[model samples]
Target: MIELKDVYKTLDGRKILQGLNLHIREGETYVIIGRSGTGKSVTLKNIIGLMKPDSGEVNIMGQCINNMGKEESYALRQKMGVLFQSGALINWLNVEENVALPLVEHQRHLSKSEVQSIVQHKLELVELEHAGKRMPSELSGGMKKRAGLARAIVGNPKIILYDEPTSGLDPVMSNQINDLIISMQEKLGVTSICVTHDMSSAYRIANRIGMIYEGQIIEEGTADQIKNSQNPIVKQFISGSTVGPLTQ
Candidate 1:
């Protein structure tokens, strides 16, 4: 459902993505694992139109986003959701309002009552049904992430992009988030692209896994295939090794 073809992106003479090509099919949970500063986040930003590629194409549902007009891009953006690494919640808004913000902005036809119901449903989907009135400061790290997930799906988006969903959480919480991600894909059939460094989370949630290094996807395979693959780069990364070609 999403394709990046020979994409190249740079900023102020620094190349962040270099001829990168990747694809995520519909209803698939694709996880991208890469070293810090290797452009994994940049790749996600390009897909979401938060960052533009210098040259090449980003196709979502067959529409080329690289060249879309402002109006067209906004319309296309309505079909996707993003959960940022920091949760990015409105610190001043309650959870319910935060979750409902997308619906309010994008779905003018819906009445407030209807939007509230949708927000409640989404919150429940993420297991935060009773936490709607809580503020960001009142939430734990995992709660904030779950609240972010609730907000992401409040609009019932066709695709969800998660940037480090497991970051800054305890092991149990990380696993819980992983299970929630898997459940969301199974229940809603949404295409998902997760950018993370957590190998265990990636293995748990990804139908297909890709390894990005030095601004390019170096390997792509099924989770089991990734585990068993003999490629030194993949092995070293998944094993959390300090020695490999990846360190060069």
Candidate 2:
């Protein structure tokens, strides 16, 4: 559903992505693993149309987004949802209003009843139906993430981008978030691209995995293939080793 071909991008004279190539299929959860500053966020930005590569193409849902006009780009981005690491909930709005913000902004044609119906369904999907009346400060870390997920899917987006979905949560809550990511794939049939440093969460949620190094994807495969990979960089990162190619 998405492809980045021979993409090269530089920011402020520093090359962040160099000849980076990636492909993700429909209805699959693809996880990207790498050390910090390895262009994971850069790749996500390119996919979301926030940043354009100086060279190479970003294809999403059949359109070459690199060349789209302003209106076209805005329309295209409506099909995407991003769950940032912080959950990014609005501090002022209650959970329900936060979840309904997308519809309020982009889908203003809908009636109040329709908006409420969508908000309610999304809350239930994320298992936060009863918490809709609560404020962001009132929620626990995991609850906030689930509410954010609800907001992301409220518009029924085709692709969901997860940025450290389990960050700042305990293991039990992390597992819950992982399960929700898997469930989103199975139930909503949406393409997912997740970038995270948590190997355990990556193993749990990814149908396929790729490891990025020095701007390009050095390895790509199924979760098991990635787990069993013999590449020194992959092994060292996954093992949490102190001494390896990455450290050197």
Candidate 3:
């Protein structure tokens, strides 16, 4: 569903992506794990067209996003949902309104009832059914993330990109978020690209896992295969060791 081929990007005189290549199959969860400043977020930005690579191609759903018309780019983005690391909810809006914002902005053909129906379904999927009337300040961190997820899926997007879905939550809440991500995949069958450092979350949610290093993917495999990888960098990373090749 998505392919980044020989992608190279530089920001602020620093090369962030160098010959980065990735292929995400449709209807599968692909998790990317890497250290800080390893181009995980940069890769996502390239895919979303927030930043174009200095060189190489980003193709989504068989179309090159690197060279698309305004209307075309906008249309392509509408098919994808993104859950930012911070949830990025509107502080002024209630949960229901936040969830309905996408439909309100796009899909103008839908009536109030239709929008409400979709919002309700998405909120329920995120397990925030009764919190619709609550404000952002009234929610816990997990609730905020869930609400953000509800807003993301309200439009029934074909792909979901999660940035640190399990970050800053207690173990229980983190597991809940992980399960919710898995639920979204199973229930909606959407292609998922999750970028996280949490190994537990990555192992649980990913059908395929890739590790990025020096701005490119150095390893890609199934969860177990990644867990059992022999590469020194991959071994040091997954083991959380400080004295291996990564640290050396």
lDDT, candidate 1, at 241: 88
Candidate 3 stretches with Cα past 4 Å from truth are none
- Of 1 and 3, the candidate ranking higher by TM-score: 3
Can you give the lDDT of residue 204 in candidate 2? 90
Q: Rate the local accuracy (lDDT) of all candidates.
A: 0.92, 0.95, 0.94
Candidate 1, residue 6: lDDT: 93
Which regions of candidate 2 fall more than 4 Å away from where they truly are? none
- For candidate 1, give the lDDT of residue 38: 84
Highest lDDT against the true fold, candidate: 2
In order of appearance, the predictions have TM-scores of: 0.97, 0.99, 0.99
Model 2 TM-score relative to the real fold: 0.99
By TM-score, the candidates rank as: 2, 3, 1
Deviation of model 3 at 143, angstroms: 0.8
Q: Report the lDDT tens digits of candidate 3 across residue range 159-233.
A: 999999888999999999999999999999999999999999999999999999998999999999999999999
